[model samples]
Target: MAWLVSTPSRKDDTGDRLFLEVAAEAARNERIRAIYLDVRAQAFANISRAFAGLMGSDAVSDEHRALAQAFMLIELGSVCARTLLNEPVQPASDRLIECLVGMPV
Candidate 1:
């Protein structure tokens, strides 16, 4: 769920942030929670795989490897949050992508 993270901000009729409003709505819905849980589980599995791959690589420096793992966790949280709101999955920002791929390793 990258769309929500990338979406422009707006104010709701109640003058509250639209993103917060949507998040609150999702929080109240059981179906949305279920979907979020499922997605979160999958995200964690993916992160585990990536971490394992990184651990096996001798080329990656410890600091950069740790950063990469942290980045995966951050991305997982972001995706799960967006999934809770049923947002479309969009590509992550180019800068973030670059950091994930180009970080000294």
Candidate 2:
């Protein structure tokens, strides 16, 4: 089951903001980690969308590319956390990274 925490004060869609808030709170509860993992996976997907322009070899917006990197880092961190907890690696992790690498930055 997913835990719904109230949104913290923030002004960006960097994904790190949400992950940090979730991780900080989840650190106190093992049961909540799975929900955080799910959220992190979603964040990875959101970040992957930034490559839309780059896919066509068009100029990508700096904002989108930067946000994408932030999203990737967050996903990587979440993967490490899952590994530490002995949870199965999220299946989309490699695929998402592959997409990132395939896209033009």
Candidate 3:
């Protein structure tokens, strides 16, 4: 959250946006879509693993994975809110992170 808040907002050139553009021109089963899907999946798995590690998950179990997923959704929503409002979401986000991370793992 700190990193997210500190970074200046530019148009985030995320894979989801890129995938949308490519998807417009490509069939669902096309290799390009498959590649993007894999990339997106791997990216998410990687993030979940990272969070699990941070939260001291030895095996990245389902509970840990769900916790990580929740974090991702919150992170994405906070980013979207910040972007749309063109404002800083620091103390609120910081507090939220504290409440989340401080939870029993």
Candidate 4:
């Protein structure tokens, strides 16, 4: 007797790009990327209070939250530093990188 197939194998699927994979997963699942962005924003808005709440819940891992908080502060410092220098960091791309990769003062 022949056995029945339960799950599809790689041969049965079409390849997807990185962006497509992320978009498709976000579309089909509840845990979309947008939700993470929103939660991360809220976490920063009230970090002292939210940190306590975040510690109590499991929606976001504690380590990830800590990293995000540190990154947020770095971004804030980059913006403030540029404003003070009067260098007029006109192009937004550089500012974005500074926010993401620059160190906090």
Against the true structure, whose TM-score is highest?
Answer: 3
In angstroms, the error of model 1 at 103 is 12
lDDT of 1 by residue, 1-105 (tens): 233223222212243334345546669998876766676557555544554455465343555446545665545444454545545334443345445545444
Model 2 Cα shift for residue 87 (angstroms): 35
What clash count goes with each model? 0, 0, 0, 0
Question: lDDT tens string, model 2, 68-102?
Answer: 66555645555444534534444444444555555
Q: If scored against the real structure, what TM-score would every candidate get?
A: 0.37, 0.36, 0.57, 0.30
Candidate 1: list runs displaced more than 4 Å.
1-24, 57-69, 76-105
Candidates arranged by lDDT, highest first: 3, 2, 1, 4
Off by over 4 Å in 2: 1-21, 57-105
Model 2 alpha-carbon miss at residue 58, Å: 13
Candidate 1 has its poorest 10 consecutive residues by lDDT at 4-13
Number of the candidate with higher lDDT, 3 or 4: 3
Q: What digit string (tens of lDDT, one per residue) describes model 4 on residues 74-95?
A: 4444344344343333344344
Question: Positional deviation of 5 in candidate 4, in angstroms?
Answer: 44
Please give the CA lDDT of all the candidate structures. 0.48, 0.50, 0.59, 0.42
How far in Å is the alpha carbon of 63 misplaced in model 2?
Answer: 16
Model 2 residue 1 CA deviation in Å: 33
